[model samples]
Target: MAKETKAQRETVERVMREWKDGALETSRGAPVTSQQQAVAIALHEAGQSRDETPAKNRKNLRTTKAREAKASETREVLYAEATKRGIPGRSRMTKQELVRALQPR
Candidate 1:
């Protein structure tokens, strides 16, 4: 029930149809790849009207913000640790790769 732009609505509808057509997978239900899909499905299950704003959408937005903040903090810490350790290419490495590289052998 979030106020979606036309493009967003089309994207959600396409995803749902593809899911039904067996053209998509949840990729083992990984949160990153499936988050939007989950939201769409949840709205559908809750009988969310396109014109009515959903309370759960607001709650979910808060949750998403919290997750993003945590991830940003983690990236900052990882960058600092990598810099301290003098890890080559640390600046270019992604968060997950930095974490793997910094893990104890």
Candidate 2:
């Protein structure tokens, strides 16, 4: 882990305090309801958390986005996409399987 600057540390503290006070919000105008989400938002606002470098933070952000995107899709939607794509064995495939089949390469 890299050393965090005073400003960065302060940023985290401020954001966390906001979260604790029920004043923290996500970029999309949603109220931050989870400690994990608050921490991620705090670290992002600070440009880095104590535990990760900037590069790692960006990577984690990308991974979180991808997972959220996947989770946003319903099983019925996945099935429709799989059917449209003519995926093999889609009839018996699970929702996860359909998602994997439909995932962009």
Candidate 3:
């Protein structure tokens, strides 16, 4: 299981949501339209950039998986969990969108 700190997960969710709404912008004030670019920007802003070496990335993943309460699971795992949890519109959600819908307030 991966453990995303609440703040980290929220950062990703907020950024992606803004991207979907055509509200996310780049450093140059251009609207962010690419999903991949949005994710990269989200992670980078969260200080978990994928630009790092593979080993470091793997280490980060492992650490997240081994974390305690409310641990974040793998995409497949989380997807299945979401299905069972009856998350609305889950059938249309990409793996990265899980955090936003979980136990939504």
Question: Regarding lDDT, does 1 or 3 come out ahead?
Answer: 3
lDDT of every model, 2 decimals: 0.57, 0.76, 0.67
Q: Compare candidates 1 and 2 on lDDT and give the better one.
A: 2
Task: Return the number of clashes found in candidate 2.
Answer: 0
Tens-place lDDT digits, model 3, residues 1-105: 346677667667877888999998896779998999999977765446657765665555444333322245666776787889988888788765765456334
Q: Per-residue lDDT tens digits of candidate 2, residues 1-105?
A: 667777567767878998999998785668999999999888876668557776886665455456447757998988887888888899898876776677666
lDDT (Cα, 0-100) at 88 in candidate 1: 97
Encode model 1's per-residue lDDT on 13-96: one tens digit a residue. Answer: 655665656554453543334557655653443335353356665544444344334455577798998899999999999996
Candidate 2, poorest ten consecutive residues by summed lDDT: 59-68
Candidate No. with top lDDT: 2
Q: Rank the candidates by lDDT, best first.
A: 2, 3, 1
**Residue 85 displacement in candidate 3 (angstroms):** 50
lDDT of 3 at 39: 92
What C-alpha lDDT, on a 0 to 100 scale, does residue 29 get in candidate 1? Answer: 43
